[model samples]
Target: MERALKRYWPIFILPTLLAFLIGFIVPFVQGLYLSFCQFTTVNNAKWVGLSNYIKVFKDTTFTDAMKFTIAFTVVSVILINVLGFAIALALTRKLAGTNIFRTVFFMPNLIGGIVLGYIWQILINCVLSIVGEPLLALNTQAGYWGMIILTCWQQIGYMMIIYIAGLQNIPDDLIEAAQIDGASSWTTLWRIKLPMVMPSITICMFLSLTNGFKLFDQNLALTAGEPYHSTEMLAYNIYNTFYARAGAQWKGIGQAKAVIFCIIVVAISMIQLKATRSKEVQQ
Candidate 1:
């Protein structure tokens, strides 16, 4: 069986490799090239060198979006992981109706991002109407918090599930041993459970970080970066630059922003993974 599998591995891998080259690698290379050229379409690309990047750096809207996205990612990553881990801890404690609770909590994650955005927008607007605020679109602070709340609500449950799996995988003997050693519950959790769950933490943090960075549909549907574009995030900013602007130069600038976005995300994700993985203990 091992011999058969090894012999046929390349045959099975070839299609996927080809598809990846066609779907991702090709477009990625092309996008990198287009970032240095001005063009309305791929066929008409004209080399403009680093002027696109220069424009990207000079654009105040892009700078604001970059700052906004970083802030949002930082806040969301902290909230989602802390809340998700707390909920996972609670649900794993043999509480009554835990299955039902899990299902209820996780159901929000199944909803589409666009749908969740619209739903929250209506709910938030209804509440704000009582106080005579215009709407989420008109209040930058409110829109910022609304996006944070919506992201946390949608993501926490999914992260909780991952934490639960990590919690469950912990050996009963180790926990019992800690108890036998007169360790308090807090001590046991800090010394044993958390270290054991570091793998889950890594995964959750990576997901949350990347999701926060790449978020667009929710940003679009929720606030649409209203109130003079104060709430626009990097992804939405790039998108608007690509399609909403009048001239061909904007496309190259947008592509440059995308490349920068990709680099930031990848670099941050790699650093996070390395930091978390170092803390993880072998079972």
Candidate 2:
């Protein structure tokens, strides 16, 4: 059976491999090439060399978006993971209605990002209006915090579920041994549960980090980079550069921005994965 499975593995994998190459790899390679060319369409690309990349750096909007995105991602990742882990810890206890609570928490994640954004926008605006405060789009600080709240509300539940799974998978015997050894709850958690749950921590951190960086639809629906693009994130900034503007040069510049965006996300995600995975326990 093992020999037959091994021999047929390539056959099973071939279709998916071909689809990946056609769907992702081919387009990615073409995009990397087009980033160096000026073209309104793929068929009419004219080599422009490093001009697009140079323009990308010169664009202050792009720089502001990069800064805003980095700040948002950092805050959102920390809040989502910490809150999710805390909620997971609470729910894992022999609490009443645990399943119901989990379902309630996770339901927000099932909502579309655009829908969540609009819903939060309305809700926040209503509250602000009641208090005579400026609307989300009119206030830079409000817009920033609005995105953070929207991201955390949508993501914390998903991270909580992962944390719950990790907590549940801890060996009962190991926990019992810690208690039997006169270990305090905090010590047991820090020494045993944390190390044991490092795998989930790694997965949750990776997802949160990437999601924060790649965020677009929510940004579009929520603030739309209002108050002079001060709240714009990198993804939304690229979208504006790509589709919201005109001309072949803009297209080339957008492509270049996309390539740079891809590199930033890939680099940060790799660093986060490496950092988290290093702390993960073997079990």
Candidate 2 C-alpha error for residue 54, in Å: 0.7
| Cα misplacement distance, residue 275 of candidate 2 (Å) | 1.0
Model 1 Cα lDDT, one tens digit per residue, 211-243: 999999999999999988899999999999999
Off by over 4 Å in 2: 1-3
**How displaced is residue 92 in candidate 2, in Å?**
0.9
Clashing pairs in model 2, backbone N/Cα/C closer than 3 A: none
Model 1 segments more than 4 A misplaced: none
What TM-score does candidate 2 reach?
0.97
| RMSD value for candidate 1 | 0.9
Kindly provide the TM-score of model 1 when superposed on the true structure, using C-alpha atoms: 0.98
User: Which ten contiguous residues of candidate 2 have the minimum total lDDT?
Assistant: 274-283
